[model samples]
Structure formats: structure tokens, C-alpha cells
Target: MKKVSFLLSASALSAIAVPALAQDVVFKPVVEARLRYETVDQAGPAPLTSSRDANAVTMRLRAGGEISKGPFAFLAEGEGTLAIDEDYNSGVNGKTLYPIVADPENVELNRLQLQYRTKPLIVTVGRQRINLDDQRFVGSVAWRQNEQTFDAVRVEYMGVKNLKVDVTYAISARTIWGIDGGKFGSANRPTQIDGDDVFANVSYKTKLGTLTGFAYLVDEDEAVVALRRNSSQTYGARFVGALPFTKKVKLSYLASYARQSDYATNPVHYSADYVAAELGLDVAAFKLTGGYELLGSDAGATGIAGGFAFQTPFATLHKFNGWADKFLATPGTGIQDYYAGIGYTVPKIGKAGPLVASFTFHHFSSDRLSIHYGDEYNAQVTMKLNKHLSALIKYADYERKGIASFTGDADTKKFWAQIDYAL
Candidate 1:
């Protein structure tokens, strides 16, 4: 025979090329880089250029890859941002007298997915990146610089045992101002928003910790008209925990609640509520915190200044109420925050890696309107300049009292410096 039929056809093509080279060795590659410097000093009223101060220099780049087999997996990502010294107003670059540095510039295609897993269940599809939990009403705003994504279809279920269940539906919603950001009634960056949105979450884990429940339904069409009056529907619950108070101490807590109304082609009918609570303590590395939050108010049907409130508009609102961001919307006479903090870590130098410092304070008011929208002070320092680098320096200050029937405005400050690298 012809050399024993060529060694049985080369062992059947090496058993199909060794399982496709072991599925390309489970490909994986994702990179990240960020560099930023921001500054803003506000006191309000600068109709396009009287100078309220603003200085921004940004850079962000993300690239991606992911692959798998045996349950399927795939991912793709791309993001970019560049604005070297834009001197403010990046709300799609109108440069309105400086101030709002919403990080514009552009590049897109951030995340393309496909997944499937098992053990309980899991599934994902299309453009992704949905951050629930602590995102405080869904997120991915990722502190601007072009983030926020969706275009979904997601699912998860953890077959009980500590539980977990997630769901998503989405149709569009991909804003952070990239790719020339504009469309859908653009007044300043809209970059896609076609909605049908839906999200759900369920969590469980115990021993005094974890517990969640959520629901969100946001619907929009054509767009504009203030995002179709920001169509809404929400429901929530949260609980977080920690306890050990000894052996170096520990105690942490959080509680949350939510409620909202008006949905589908909303034309304003109103109903709102939201609340939060927090407490923390650590010891050993020192840490302390206190918090309270509320965002309720809604007096529709001719109640004057009460069309709506309790909005999140896809949160990550600069991590909440004031980073000098001065309430990223949610004040149709609603908002009440009171906060406190303290932190410290340091104690890892040599090869460089850990370091932290913090301070915070905030007090804002107005829920049903007694006004008093001000008082803030924050500071930070962070570092982890090692395995892939990290660094940050931040500050924020806000002071504006508002009393005579809400006069709030003027007095604000912000600053930041950051660097990051990852792979």
C-alpha cells in the first residue's frame, strides 16, 4: 500500500489541528491607558464666554480582545478620546464659555459581545457593558471619557445556592460623546439612544451580607423632547454588609431604596422617591464614613416647579451628588445629601503599589424645597504605581447656600490629575 496510506492520512490531520490550536490558546488581550488633567472653577452665568474657567487635557484609549471555546465566548472593544487642552465645554465641543468638560473628541465601537456559559446559566449578546449593583441604577458612565454602552440582551441565573439573577433587554443607548456625538435631538451630544431598555437584578448571598433587588424600565423613541421626558419606571432595594468589629475591627453597611414613575412616552405625570444610607468603619488602615441621600419630589399636574425628580439618568454621576459636579440633574426640587468620610492606607512602598488618602464632606438640601443647595469639600490621593501603574490626585469644593427661594449658584471648584495603564 502507498506507505500505509500515508500514515493514516497524517493521523487524520493531527486530529483536526489539535483542537484548532487549543482554540487559539484562549485568546485574550485588552489594554487600557488613561491620562488626564482637569480643572474647572465655576461661579455660574457665562453665556458662552465670559470665562468661568475650565481646563482639560484628556486621553483615553482602550483596545480589546477576548476569545474562548467550550461554552462560547467572544468580545471586541475599541474606544478612544483625545483632547489635549480643550479649555472646557466638551459637551460635544461647543465650548460654552468653558466649564462643562464632558470629555468629547471621539472614536467608537466599544464592546461587541457574544457569550454563553453554564453551571447555572449565562448569556450575553451584542454591544455590552452594563454595570449594575453599586453603579446605583445601572452604569458604565465610567467617569466619562467616552463610556456608557448597551444594545443588549443579557441573562444570568445562578441556579440558586446564594442566588443571583440578572436580565437586560436594551436596544440602544450608547452615549458618552464619541464618534462626533450628536443625533436624536442633539442639543449637546446624544450619540445614539433609541430605547426600549429594561434591566433587572436579583442577588442574594448571606452571612449578613449582600441582598439586592432591582428593576428599571426606560423607554424612548425617536428621541429628544428632553429624552421623551426621560421616560421612567424603577423599583429597587439594596443592602450590603460587613461585620467583624474586632481583630483589627470592621463594620460596614449600606441600605438603599428606590421608586420612580412615568413611563412610555412620558409627558410627565410624576412620582418619585429614593433614599440611601451608609455607615462604615475599619481599623488597621483607618477608614470611616457616614452617609445619607435622598432624591424625591414630584408634583406633576400643575404643581409648578415639580415636574419630576429622583433621576439617575444612568448613574455613576461622578460617584454621587458632588465631585463639584453639582448635582448632575435631579433637582426639580429634590435632593438631600449629607455625607462624611475619612480614609488612609499607605504602608507599601518599596516596589511601589498601595497608597491612599481621602477626605470628604457634603451637605446639600431641598427635597420638597426649603432650598440650601450647597456645601462640599473633597480631597483625594491615590496610587498603585506598580503592576501596570495608577495614580490620581483630586479635589473639589462647592459652596453656595441658596435660601431666598432657591438662589443657588456660584462658587465651585474642581481639579484632578490621573494616570492609568493596564493590560
Candidate 2:
């Protein structure tokens, strides 16, 4: 309660400060609402079978204004959540015996920042979102009901055309999902880490294609420090452009390699490497994509390991191969995944928005060639009701091909319907 009070007070005071300079300040209020229904058929291992069928509602209200007179600007946003249907936990094998105190009604601040923008340079400090090139490993985790936001200081320079640079330093992480929520971990010992990460990227365009190079550095704290020892770094490049074959067809590709050393948060001192590549083609109303990834692992290594696969903490994360979430932590043996998919947009109906649909198939294997593999199928559909409203539904299934791990081979199914409105 005290923390929330402090934040609200701070926001009010910050807003008042802008008018002192006699600059005409403009305040814009922002608001958004979302309602979701989800059903989980199975979760976790036996003796603790878990599943949930519940309805969740989230709301966000924000008031921010600009100090039009100067190069300074400020913004603040807050959000809260609510859950309906108290008996929903029964779907998880009678695990809802206790009173539900953690149901989404908790209110929290999402973003509060002050910025200074000038020709060629821009600086921002406060709670915000940090997303860089594809958001593979480092991202804001925005798929959940509440989006994960970072508290940091960032700067950018764009003095030259076709060339841009950015840097960010974080002091804390205000995760959208509750610390004790299953989305993160057990309530008994919720994990929270404080640290800093830096990222830089440079891009150039030519007649044939555009090339981009990026690097990242992440330093961990004590609690999360074990996840990445002193620090971790990544370097990679990407090229995307249209094909010379024809004017109606387009092609794109991405390739990256990362090396991990003792800087990893684990106690074990080991090094790993990752390689990933993807190819995509666009023609008419349909799009096709395929990709391959290989994560390196030493057979003798112990502890949670790293992989080269593209890690998206958001974007319907469960759609990826392997178990929906069983491999979120990644195994030391490493992994290899081959995937392909197609996407198309259906023609719009009279007075209705267009329908978007996609299907993807993925095959997963161990980089060490030890265990058998598995595969998954994912499909989803989405439609927009209007400029500010949209709806979505998705499904995913994973099947074991050979050997299986504790993650389970038993088929799992999930269904979700959601409506979002923004202003």
C-alpha cells in the first residue's frame, strides 16, 4: 500500500513540475481494458496435477502530458487486474482448496518516465520497455495479461541517416506477472533479480539489401546472478531484402551466432555457442517461413545451459516446439529445432474486419544426439473488431516421438479467447 501511494504521489508531483517553467504543457490521458478466458488441461507433474479454467480482466489508466515548450517530456502509466470464477482452479485436479488471494485485482504502476529529445540525441530515464532486434533473448515479456516493464535509463543517437545507435542500463525489473504467480515460480520463494544490460546495433542499406549488426551485455545480481555469472555477451548480424527473381515475390533471411563463457550465472564454468538461421518468402496473400537453430553443449557439463535458439518470452510463447513451457529454463544438453509455417489473411467480410490465420510445425531434438525428439503443431486466428478492439483464439499440441522426459509426452491442450480495447 505504501509503495503504491508513493508512486501515485510521485507521479502527481512530476506532472505539476512541468508547468513551473511557464511552458504550455499538454496532458493526455490513456486507458485500456482487456478480458480473457483461458483453460489449461494439464500443468506440472503427477501428485500435483494442475489445470485452470478461469476468466481474467485487466485495466490500465494513465495520465501523461508533454511540456511542449522545451525538449523535455514526461509520461506515466498504471494498470490493475481482476479475476472471475473462484472455482476455476478445480480443473487442475482439485488444487483450489485454499482461498484465492492472488487473483488478478492487484494494482501496479507500469511505466513512468521523463525524456529529453534533441537533434541527433535522445535520453530517457525511468520505468519503460526495452525491446531490441527481434526480442529473442532479452525482451520485456509482453504476452501475459500484464506486460513486463523495465526500470532503466536509455539513450539513443541518430545523427546519420541509415545509421542508429542505442544503449540502456537497468536498475530494477518491475515484472508484470506477480512474483509468486506460477508464471514466474512457486509462491514459497518467488525470485526477483536486479542487474543491468546493454545493447547496441548498427544498420546500413544498399540497393540489394539491408545489413544490421548487434551486440548485448547483461550483468546479473546475487539472486539472479547465478543465472549469469559476471556477465554475458552476444554478437550477430542480419540481412533482409527482396529477391531478384521477380517483382511480386520477396525473400528475407537472418543469421546470428553467440558465445557464452563463465559469465553465465551458473556455478559450473563452461562455454557454449549458438547458431540460428531463417528464410522467409512472401507472395500474394500468403507467407511462408522456415528456420533451423543449434545450441552447443558439452556432454560433461552440468547445470542449466544456454542455447542458440531464438528465445521469445512473449508472442504466444507456447506455440514453439517442445512442451508448452517445460523447457523455458533450457537443458544443459542443448537443443536443435527445425520449423516451418504459413500465414494468410482472409478477405474482409462486409462491415467486418479481415481474418488472420496461421499454422506452424516444429521438430525438436537434442544437440548432443542423446535423447529422441518430439514435435508440435500450433494454429491461431485473430480478427479486429475495430481500430481499438480485437479478438484472438489459439491452440497448440506437442507429441513425443521417441524417448520422453519429466516434461511429459501426454498430449496437452489449451484454449483462450480475449478481447482488448484501447484509448
Considering every candidate listed, which one attains the maximal lDDT?
1
How many angstroms is residue 198 displaced in model 2 relative to the true structure, after the best TM-score fit? Answer: 2.2
- Enumerate clash totals for all models, in the order shown: 1, 8
lDDT of 1 by residue, 39-96 (tens): 9887744332236588899999999877766766667789989888888878766666
Off by over 4 Å in 2: 1-16, 43-70, 86-105, 179-192, 224-231, 244-247, 264-266, 302-323, 406-410
Q: Give the CA lDDT, 0 to 100, for residue 208 in model 2.
A: 67
Which candidate achieves the best TM-score against the true structure? 2
What overall lDDT goes with each candidate model?
Answer: 0.79, 0.59
Score every model by TM-score. 0.32, 0.81
TM-score of structure candidate 2:
0.81
Q: In model 1, which runs have C-alpha deviations exceeding 4 angstroms?
A: 1-68, 74-76, 89-97, 104-116, 123-128, 133-135, 142-145, 148-273, 276-293, 296-314, 318-325, 329-365, 372-423
Cα deviation in Å at residue 350, candidate 1?
A: 65
